[model samples]
Target: MKELDEANKKYNSDFVEKVKKTDVGENLKRIKIKKNVYIDSLIQPGFIYYIETGVVLRSFVDAAGNIKAIDILCAQEVMGLRSLIGRVGVQLEIKALEEVTILIIPEKLILANLQDAYHFLCSNFQYTMSIMYLHWQAMLSFGSERINYALIALAYYVGTEKDGEFFFPPYITHDVIASFASVTRSYVSRHVSKLADDDILVNQAKKMKIKDMDTLIKNTPNYQSF
Candidate 1:
């Protein structure tokens, strides 16, 4: 996870530098978003955003009123690309998990620059493939292992590391994990408690910390492939 974070940071830095060298980059607008705020204003057509800092939850509510978490984006992520490609019809609910800073770029600007457009598409493709891979892995698993894998996946994307331990933010409650795992909140709680008891992880104050990565991987079937 640490290596992945560093890689993303480097990529984002390089991408920003490349964009800044172009004329379109001069017109980029930066904005700050408060935690728990919905970005309705940025949902307008012909714009995309680069996440300069913090995390955001991308989700959708079904007709049954079930909220499904589609993505948990952090620093270096690009948002609104799916809409530009005409791949999404149902409106996605995007809310900040923490204070966020983003650089807004016009859609036309990106389209006019072949290199920028290609990089944007490549980043989106990598992200989509990762999500698809996790979905496929989850479908092949069952019971508590699925929940564990969900935690692992979440940690990979948004968990912060300090002194060799990984911690998920307080905003990521059991309900959020349940939504990500496509499981009931109670089921998620039970698995989480078990992991806590085993000293593999601990959940308190609405935050989760992973203590034993090896044990966690062992409990999660086929997690090494992830």
Candidate 2:
């Protein structure tokens, strides 16, 4: 993991530089989506996703009848990478946790650009696997009773800030979060209050500023051992 992080820094930098260039000579063009919304809820349900800015979550319900968030996508992360390739439409509804600008490219256009479409398909398969792994880590992080679901959501939504504060917008209501964490709204509300009372969170008009991100991450109990 340590070596991967070091290698990732170089790849990420190069990726950013490549993305900045205006001339890529592909059939792809940019489309801006300014609204803060669930991506699956907004689009016509058949567009490819390449995020230019902001974040989104690709999630669905489990067979055990639990709604779970499977992915937290950020800038440079591809959207509908898994659901729209071989599939007709998205089986999992993607929710936008933040105001976003997604570059929607047509699936046909992307396919046309691929000389080796099978290779492209394989790479997308790996990307989907990566998202699944991240979600598995998040699930393990949340299954602990020692940690509140709100903290789980925050950690999943915004892991840690540069200033070591995990600032989160209060747009996430308890009711909406209920389905994701597989907890009742009342349970989520109770934890929200506890964090606020502990001064771990400051409830702003539209957001909750979480202080002490390091302590939150550290003190957050692990469930894997149990």
Candidate 3:
């Protein structure tokens, strides 16, 4: 699993390095953003962004005016490709999870510069497929009778490891977890407490950490399939 994880990281790094060699990176405008900063979609309709560092949470406001987290993106991920290429409007609100650096590239320039847009499009398509798979997994988890396992699955999906502990990159709150898992905050709190008591999860400085990855993964729905 560690080897596979390293290979995946290498693949993403190589892909991003390839893109950086292209003309797109030569003209990209680097922007540094602080945590919790909301990126307005209207600010750059014809531009797409590559996340150079940090994490981003893509969310939408529900009818009740509650923010629902849709996806969490990390380094080497591309954002706004659908809106830029399909001419669709960006409906999701992008919020910085931590201090982030993004490289903005105009869509028109990419099309004009790339000798073969196919490669670029294929790379983006692969990322889209991964995101779709995650969404599908989440949907299936939500369909289950138990919400705790679903939340745990989500935590595993988006978490990053440091010093042998897997931590949620954005330091997710119970409210955010509740919103994503379609449960009440109290329900999430109860499960969280139970997990902590059981030593499966640990809370340190407001960040949730997985104490045992193997145990957590074993408890997740359709773990064998994963």
Per lDDT, the best of the predicted structures is: 1
State the lDDT of candidate 3 residue by residue for 85-176, as single tens digits. Answer: 66654378888878888888776566664554456566556655665565566656642223454456455566677776777754577876
The whole-model lDDT of each prediction reads 0.77, 0.55, 0.66
What is the lDDT for 21 in model 1? 67
| Model 2 residue 49 lDDT score | 63
In Å, residue 196's CA in model 2 sits off its true spot by 2.2
lDDT at residue 163 of model 1 (Cα atoms): 74
Task: Sort the predicted structures by TM-score, highest score first.
Answer: 1, 3, 2
Question: Residue 178 CA error for candidate 2 (Å)?
Answer: 3.6
Candidate 1 regions with alpha-carbon error over 4 angstroms:
1-9, 24-26, 162-164, 224-226
lDDT of 1: 0.77
Better of 1 and 3 by lDDT: 1
Cα misplacement distance, residue 39 of candidate 3 (Å) = 0.6
What's the C-alpha lDDT at position 144 in model 3?
Answer: 25
Residue 47 of candidate 1: its Cα lDDT?
Answer: 72
- The total number of steric clashes, by the backbone 3 Å criterion, in model 3 comes to 0
User: Regarding TM-score, does 2 or 3 come out ahead?
Assistant: 3
Q: Model 2, range 80-162, lDDT digits (tens) per residue? A: 55446455443676766667776656656545545444544455565555544544555665532423544554454455454
The segments of candidate 3 whose C-alpha lies over 4 angstroms from its true place after superposition are 1-26, 142-158, 162-165, 223-226
Q: Model 1 over residues 1-226: C-alpha lDDT tens digits?
A: 4454455556656766666667533788899999999985576566778889988888888888888788788788778776767766878889998999998877766766667568657756765776777777876888788788888877766777787678987878888888877778999999899889888998887768998877788888767553
The alpha-carbon deviation from the true structure for residue 31 of candidate 1, after best TM-score superposition, in angstroms, is 2.1
